[model samples]
Target: MKIVVLNGSPDSRRFELDCYLAELEGLLETRGHVVKSFELRAMNIGHCTGCWGCWVKTPGECVIRDDSQKVCRAAINSDLLLFASPVIMGFTSAVLKKISDRLIPLLHPYFEIDRGEIHHRKRYERYPAVGLLLERATDTDEEDLELIRDIYARMALDFKSELKFTGLTGNPAEEAADALDRL
Candidate 1:
């Protein structure tokens, strides 16, 4: 399988989340899967303007000539998308949210009464599985994990992918290694 791992943490290689992703990458590679990792922090990604230019003006092309479109292309070609991030206030990092927002161009838009709603019905077929790694602080509340699970659930529904969550609280390295083994 060709896998694309998106590191949502802004700290890139310095963050604990990277340890998790690295372990997973090694596991996948050992299993004869080609892995390509993208760190959201290092890429020059811009915020989505909600212009719908990608859908209306140039189909499948984003107006923003940034690294995000490149990531989107990789995602389209990948067999699995591994999304990793550090839990921040019971949610994904801002970097991941920005990436997700910019990915709006990958979705279809339907207009109704001058309002456009994104239709992601076709996006699911490209990638059937998603592996999520979340690193929570030691002091983080259990409710935070619940909130993260809820968010992942919604993401799974939208992408039509089987969402697997590996929660690494405090001991990211060990937990990540175990998670990779389980995967």
Candidate 2:
């Protein structure tokens, strides 16, 4: 399986998170799986302008010409995508949200009825399954985590993918890998 990780922590010196990701990468690689990761905070990704250029003018590609294209491409190509971010104000980091918003180009503009609701048409043949790896905030609670999970579950639906699991940074990397390995 090919996996891609989107790291959205803004701190440059994220020692524990960095080490955890490295461990996860190594575990996957040793199992003969390809793994790729992007530190979104360090990348030059711009916020989506909501112009619909990608859907209309560009046809399945963003016109911004930034690092987000690479992220989107990798994500679309992967079998699993793990979004790793620290909770900020009860949500994922803004950097992750920025790049995530940029992923709109991956879907078609036309809407289709899915599960009795309007949804964008899928542009690609396949999209990656998703997982969440979050570092809880100081004041985080169970309700906050549940809200985050529900939000990402909706995102998975929009992307035409499944959300496998949502784990926490406090968990050992081996445990997270084990959960993914089962999938």
Candidate 3:
């Protein structure tokens, strides 16, 4: 499987997270999966303009020519998408949200009639399974976990992908790797 991990924490190379991700990458490689990682802090990704250009004017492309297009391409090419972030204010980091906003072009604009009922179209070509890793300090870990789960649930609905596994309050990278291994 080709896995694309997005490190959305502002602290791209933060010690614990980095170590975890490294371990996870090695484990995945050992399991015959290629991993590609994107650190949001290192990329010059602009906020989404909500221009709907990708849907209206251009198809499957964004107007803002930046790191987002690369990220989206990676997402499209990957079999699994891992979203790793440090909990901020009981939610995902703003960096993740920004990337997600730019990814709006990947989703359908309105509803599709699957069996006579209106439903959003599946966003990805294969509906790549998602793994969420939420890192936080000791006391607030549980709360942050719940908040993160809720956030991802909403995201899953929007993206029409399944939230396969969630790792919270543990070593970010290792826990995430373990979750992926279970998949």
Candidate 4:
């Protein structure tokens, strides 16, 4: 599988998630899967101004000139797109959210009914399946994780893809990769 890992850790150098992702990358490579990753904080990603430029002025591309374009391309092309982040205030870090919001360019402005709910039309022929790799907070509970998963599940629907799984950094990286391999 061709996997693109969006490392949403705010501190790439200090976070243990970085090490865990590295191990997971190595394991995936051993299985002959192409693995690529992006350190979101290190890149020049900007906030989404909700200008709708990507949907109106320029279809399928954002007006902001930043590293998010690279992220969008990688995400659109990959077989699996892993969103990895440390839980901050019961959610993913701000940097990750910034990029995630900027990903609006990849969806069309039109809406459709999916499971009796309105959703955006897909802009791409195929969207990569999404996986969540979260690092829990000190006071993290099961509810927080479920909330995160539920939100990402809706996000998967927006992209016309599946929510593969939501794993944690505390778990062995090998196990995470093995889960993907099985899929």
Give the poorly placed runs of model 1, Cα more than 4 Å off: 111-119, 123-125, 165-183
What lDDT does the true structure give each of the candidates?
A: 0.71, 0.90, 0.78, 0.90
TM-score of each: 0.80, 0.97, 0.87, 0.97
Q: How do the residues 1-183 of candidate 3 rate in per-residue lDDT, one tens digit apiece?
A: 889989887874467666677778888898888999998889999998889888778877888899999999888778788898777777778998899889877876767875465667765666667878767755565666887788786677667677888875464555556668768
Error of 1 at 78 (Å): 1.6
Please estimate how well model 3 matches the true structure, expressed as its whole-model Cα lDDT. Answer: 0.78
Per-residue C-alpha lDDT of model 1 across residues 1-183, encoded as one tens digit per residue:
677878888774555677656766786677677889998898899998988898889877789899998898888787667677887777878998898787666555652221244435553346536667777765568888777777776676566455764455355445554554465
Query: C-alpha displacement of 10 in model 3, angstroms?
Result: 0.4
Query: What tens digits encode model 2's per-residue C-alpha lDDT throughout 12-105?
Result: 8767677778888898788888999998888999999999999889899998998988998899999998999988899998989998899999
Question: In candidate 4, which residue ranges exceed 4 Å CA deviation?
Answer: none
Best by lDDT: 4
Q: By summed lDDT, which 10 consecutive residues of candidate 3 come out lowest?
A: 168-177
List clashing residue pairs in candidate 3.
Answer: 20-173
Clashing pairs in 2: none
lDDT at residue 9 of model 2 (Cα atoms)? 91
Compared with the true structure, what per-residue lDDT tens digits does model 4 show for residues 101-172? 998988999998988999999888999999999998898888999999999998889988889978999898
TM-score of model 1 vs. true structure: 0.80
Candidate 2 ranges with C-alpha deviation above 4 Å: none
The positional error of residue 175 in candidate 1, measured at the CA in angstroms, is 7.3
